[model samples]
Target: MTKSLDAHYRAVVVGGGQAGLSASHYLQKLGIDHVVFEKNTVAHKWKNERWDAFCLVTPNWQCQLPDHAYDGTDPNGFMVKEEILAYVDRFVKKVNAPVFEGTSVTSLEKVGNLFRIQSSAGSVTADSVILATSLYSQPFVPRAGERLPEGITQIHTADYRNPAQLPEGAVIVVGSGQSGCQIAEDLHLAGRKVHMVTGNAPRCARFYRGRDVVDWLADVGQYDITIGHDGMAKKKHDTNHYLTGRDGGRDIDLRKFALEGMALYGRMTGVSNGKMLFQPDLKSNLDGADRVYNGINALIDRHIAEKGIDAPEGSPYVPLWEPEAETTELDLAAEGITSVIWATGFTPDWSYVGLPIFDGTGYPVQHRGVTGVEGVYVLGLPWLWTWGSGRFLSVGKDAHHVVDHLAAHLDRTRRPLKQMANG
Candidate 1:
């Protein structure tokens, strides 16, 4: 028989990164007796991420948890990994969020309305569990990746950190997403011949009103906008652009790397012997990206025109917007790209939760994160509600909203005082 563990709180939070920490912070404010279970140290993934010269795409001014700022000299600047880690550490201390570090929640199952969670440290019965782990839990290398010839070495972008870590031979980055592009650029700069496998070319803003695109988003309520599935799909289809470039006093573009002859390919299908190959439709993907960019520009113009908005006499004219199509698949072995980094995107996996309450997509079936499975909630999902809920720097606010909703639910549905005392 399993030993009965204490159930002192209504909720238990999983993970110790920004999402979990932020949830714990709000639970404290609401006087909820809660604890965070972290499989590793604070911001563990960030520490383990292969983020060489990586900086937050979101601006620093918007990157603070409630009741705490980064507390550094450059509060308005985007922070690197070190700065972010330090900030999270400080936030934990400041809020006094109850956390159990090194404690990993191994499994979770819904027993009636309550969730029985098993952890490496101990078992806990919580009325609810907040899964704050990021969607990037699983690095998705393509299926064909497994069949590569034994002679070549393969490393996902998740495993890539710096230029020196890569093999001396020519490198090919598989995905055209942010991670793939960044890694490709880094490898190329390190004096290694690099090939960027084209999946799809994304539209990137030239300048958002004479400032960084991130800055413009913040200014134009993009961060505040809550978009649902339709909105998110529209955004993705409409804006194929990925955020790139270092901050250049508010406006920096990374056209230099592209202009420097980064060898571009169509796409990778498979590998044979030791030779890597690529498809021939590489130009089509590039063209699709261009069309997307033009579409976004056109949309901006339409929005301005529809509003009959008057800009300053010297202001740049905004273009009308439209969305471009996706790209076709390509052959890999023919192009001789031995190494491939899968940067397609990320998805949330709640298999460990082991709860039947999850949707087909592994997301909790809820109205704004409150599932029928009592005492369970979720936060920090992309576009949680059409209003730009899960942006790079939007976790804190999302956590707060989730915590509030959970707190109210717990208060209204908590077991009676006498029943609690007997337990």
Candidate 2:
């Protein structure tokens, strides 16, 4: 027989990161009683990110909650991983929302418009379930990753801390996202001969016209990315959005590093005799990334023009770091690279939830935040709506919308039926 608990809540939000905390804030604003289930400590990922040198892509001005904004030394300053985690913790404590930290939800099953969530601490039934887990939960490493020669050391970006933690010698950094680029930069700065395995080198601006790129986005209402369909759709194309290099307004550039000696290659194929082999798709992927960057710039230009703002003059386009193509296998022993950092991306894994609502890709099928199975909702998912809701600050307003919708649905759907025993 299943066990039972006396206490009950109107909703249960899983994960206490930015998304979950935002959701809780909104739930309270609407006077909806809810409990948060965090598998690890609050801001678990950010705390563990201790990745020697990690910072937010978006600036501090954009790092905000509904009415609460980041008030610190520099409003336009970029935030470090530790600062971001501390911000989340402070927000939770400020709200005084009931959060059950270190409690992992093992399974969530839907029965008659009421979802039963089973966790290690205990079980609770709520009218709605909010999955605040983001895309960073599951690291997306290729199948060939497992087959690499045993001599090479491999570490995922999630597990990486600093250059000191890596194996001595030349280092290979995989994936070209913000994480990958930052990791490669860190390793290279540590005087380690670094080889960057290129995937998609998207264009990124460092600062825009004397301020952080995030400030530019905010000034142009781009930071309020949560309000429009164009913003939402643009975010969906994640692979294209955050392109590499420096911002249009900054004199600094990443091309300097690539030219300095970061060996760029196509994607990795497999390893043989402790030698790493790469495929020929590197250039093409980079080309695709270029197209995406251009598209974003074009979109931003249009937005600025529509708002009748003075266009900042200068080379908006950052020069590409074109690498010479030479197909060859690399032997680590000769190169002296003891550690490999996998800057590969992340994916959402909802396998433990056991929910009936899922698409062909095993992702939850929902209209907005509502799932097909009643009483089940999802929050904090990147690009959950059109644009703003997935990112940290952008998700706040969206979370409010979700809470209101859920509150109405709960009142309308939930009846005076007997509560099932918690298991």
Candidate 3:
């Protein structure tokens, strides 16, 4: 719903995703006057950017929005796409946020003491700004995809719906991140021939010991660990371990797929003539993924033993299949490959904000959600505060921290003015 836009506000939130809405909830709780500008409808990414079988990798219990947690019966289960949409919709209605849907903030700059925002809906001024855009807003397909035969139907996973959507033939799925692995499994399960280019992204067991790995990790306080932990800051940039929550949660084991006739390849190089090329790193990629998988399980084992928890025993993962021949090249036509799915993921684009707050990598320089520059705050970034900071579970916590700081800062500044006026 479009609301009446005013000339000025105490705070202005850019981007109306979970992060933005969470911040809006807190600001409203504190009686702060603000407007949330959403370029698209709320949860637009979830609505459009996902494949058909999309479900939460984390359990439904982790759907911790501000003032709302998952109240469904399937707390341990993952919420499917439809349920996820409904959840976000409920939050939008609950907040009754002061938002301008379809309003895009084209540019934002600090004008004197106020932040001036130019949006599709027009300009507005604010005392402070919350840049609440998601971590990855733009889908990235490599230029190498262009080198492929124009005959092959090419798509990024964001556009992928199901196996029925692709032409009937073998499909080459690139990248081994969450989407890549899951889509490959989806196609494979649908009896479509799948050839995957497995990247060095890690994998994890969906269930370890007697409970889901997520439950165990949460018990170990993993989600609460901040980004400042040793060797943890860099984890923000790491690829999430490949797993799936479809038809109940399960590990996405590429080796198991390979054993079941799914051809596995290494990183994609380029296409020449009709042949798809790859580096001869298939064996190493598989092993590296397994190491992370086993390592995580081992951590859980230690925690269980130390606490003497009576959980079912588990064993380390032994490779189900190994690649003896690393095929660095493949004749696409001979292999009957008719389509390519690039699950290469996304990159952040924040060119509109006329601020020197971003790092060389385009990440905003911020402590928690508060940016280095005064009056500028960023939210919903992965590892912004913790491992789950960008996730549904922890986004609310981060929002509270930032809004608390914002409120306190405003109050402290206001006290001086009141004192000066009275004096």
Q: Where does candidate 3 stray beyond 4 Å?
A: 415-423
Q: Which ten-residue region of model 2 has the weakest summed lDDT? A: 243-252
Q: If the candidates were sorted by their TM-score against the true structure, best first, what order would they fall in?
A: 3, 2, 1
* Number of the top TM-score candidate: 3
Q: Which is the better candidate, 1 or 2, if ranked by TM-score?
A: 2
Question: Between candidates 2 and 3, which one is better according to TM-score?
Answer: 3
* Model 1 bad stretches (over 4 Å): 1-8, 70-76, 229-240, 245-259, 275-280, 298-339, 344-347, 386-388, 415-423
Give per-model CA RMSD.
Answer: 5.9, 5.3, 3.5
**lDDT of each candidate versus the true structure:** 0.63, 0.69, 0.89
Best model per lDDT? 3
Q: Give the Cα error of residue 1 in candidate 3, in Å.
A: 3.9
lDDT of 1 by residue, 284-360 (tens): 76666656655655555554466665642223333223113223333334545455556655555676778666655
Mind giving the per-residue lDDT tens digits that candidate 3 earns over 93-174? 9998888989888899988878899999999998889999977788899988888887899999999999999999999999
lDDT at residue 246 of model 2 (Cα atoms)? 19
How far is 35's C-alpha from truth in model 3 (Å)? Answer: 1.0
